[model samples]
Target: MSSHLLSRPLLLRHLPSLSFPLSNHRFRPRRLSSSAAVRPPATPEPAVSVAISADERYGKKQIISVTPQIYEYILSNVREPPILRELREETSSLRGSQMQVSPDQAQLLAMLVQILGARRCIEVGVYTGYSSLAVALVLPDSGILVACERDARCLEIAKKYYERAGVSHKVDVKHCLAVDALNSLIQKGEAGSYDYAFIDAEKRMYHEYFELLLKLVRIGGVIVVDNVLWHGNVSDPLVSDPRTISIRNFNKKLFEDKRINISMVPIGDGMTICRKVLQY
Candidate 1:
């Protein structure tokens, strides 16, 4: 069994000490648009290796976590796609580093799009555009993916990815706070138009995003939210961080939300997959 369950509880991870000063060791984004928490570049490890082992440290049956070979393959592909080699080099030159959707995650998203035959998609965060590319890759030529990105700096990187992947025609980038972008789209009669929506922007707005997404995504469409675990602190009662509490509360609400069928997967911090079951 895969030891690393995506739904597994999040734990605060510690980094190895190095000459890089403490402040320097911190994963600070060079720009505010770097929405993802930057981690140390992954060292090449054995293919399909264990990532997190569920041992008896807690005196219970453990789950052995493994990073699939596909993950490494995706990293390798991203590191070497020929057409976009120059664009990627420029992206790194501008962004200072690479942050992308793992190959497993990319394939997972793509499979969903293809299997569900999603012709329209909405993505809340564009980041380096990996997620958007993932969605667009499986879409029909007529499909459209609307991506909301507030940071022009990061969106620039995303644009390159879209171009390199030859999917720019399928993606429309909206530069604005996600909420405003969604509000305007709805105003323009884009409501209930999306077959799939992925939400991964600012955490505190998850609830609001859901409300807006519900209107924008048609009944029977699905909405996916990332980072619901917030690095394992969602259960810490004493910690009332707005983002964490908001997620925990959202999870609670989803469980009781008869309007949609939900499955919170333990994938990449956590992905709450909700398929709208009720027509508004």
Candidate 2:
């Protein structure tokens, strides 16, 4: 008999007649001495609760935070031409400078134009012409970019850059409300003629611009909508601002719309690339 079994007289009395061999470690009861230390049960770590609380406070994670170093690295790698760099730097000091697209976004737009072999393009909001210039630079010599902007001062700056870049012949500036300009084009039997369109105008009239542009761009043509995320405000339920609500509703409308195939890219505020798949 083991010493553990011998120490417990009450346990020994209830034992069956069949003896357990001393060498049978499986049946042996561990000796519990007075000096033996007892371990307390582990408490749950606080990290799990902290993470849950954070998720609740901030909503689900939607995008990776682009730090300054990362943005610098991205800019360093992009092939920003001299005239474009000058235009961007000059626009930085102007009011509403934030309206201009970032260098990386300009690169993406230029690449898209090249990929589409886009000859006829339309820009709804040409704020100082960074994006327009980028697209025009990639276009063939015969390509044309129709730019719409109501602000004369901004248009003048854009024209200066276009002239400097020697792409002035390729750009046709429309000094009128974008809707009026688009309507005029449709009136002239120019519907379904454009290869590409970019919308970055008034937030309230996005749907109008979209509807008008849908008629302007040809089948299989692409329309790139900027500020779709509205600085990550579209996903936040707490943000009930007019612009945010408008963008949220617009995003939902685009998702449910069957006429076009869409992809919402998370680059620079956010851009929704919609390719018209059905004419109806």
Candidate 3:
């Protein structure tokens, strides 16, 4: 990997932080085309008085809500490879299509891989292989990705896409629980060997996955956790569902963790990108 590609500044730029001030760098503002520019309504509508909800009054507005039109524009702007587009289209008809990562998220994952110049990676969930294919496509010919998934059917779909993308050799599919696969990797003395990892499996086991991944990934390696926001339910006091609670607790744990630096981004539900700062 080129030294410039793996520069600390480049890696830290993507991983937001408040603990340390980021080095000042000039960034060119994106210029939108005339059609893509946001315009106010042609006709001004009369303002109507509406009672503000408690949540609305006190809640912080950081990330913008992605409306359907906005999402369509994002999809049009993002560059999706032909094979990934085909896989995403095919996965949409499946039963758990919603579980798959969005195209923009996939693009982000691929960019992370390239930015880090990662050679070895891991994917805790492989739903229809959309994200995995994205990562595999960006990895070099010698790069390898250990993909763990229990669903045989989903794995089969992933395998088909991997073959079509001609990156089958780069993916090592493990048809077992994520915990077992992660443990197996540790037992084989692969601790702190991976360059990157992505977790999108069982919500309840997120903490466990983090602990294991911390050991498997070397110091400075990156771990990306998906669905951290749980459709905005994590902050809702009324929603005490098991899955929501699990994700909420996981987010808290990540916040308190000092071994890794984290940035929770509101993209594709939500994703927390962690960079290991200390070894386990």
Alpha-carbon local distance difference test for all models? 0.69, 0.81, 0.81
Q: Candidate 1 lDDT, tens digit per residue, 159-238?
A: 87788788899998999988998999899998988899988887878889888999988888999888776676786788
For candidate 2, write residues 53-167 as lDDT tens digits: 3476777655434443244444456677778767877887888887888777888999999999999999999989999999999999999999999999999999999999999
Ranking by TM-score: 3, 2, 1
Candidate 1 vs candidate 2: which has greater lDDT? 2
Per-model TM against the reference: 0.70, 0.77, 0.79
Write down the TM-score for model 2: 0.77
Error of 2 at 108 (Å): 0.3
TM-score top scorer: 3
Model 1, residue 180: what's the lDDT?
Answer: 91
lDDT of 3 at 3: 40
What is the Cα-based TM-score of model 1?
0.70
Q: Show the colliding residue pairs in model 2.
A: none
Candidate 3, residues 1-280, lDDT tens digits: the string is 2344222111111111111111122222344579877665698533322243457677644433444334444545567777876777677678878788877789899999999999999999997898999999999999999999999999999999999889999999999999999999999999999999999999999999999999999999999999998867797899999999999999999999999999998777789999999988
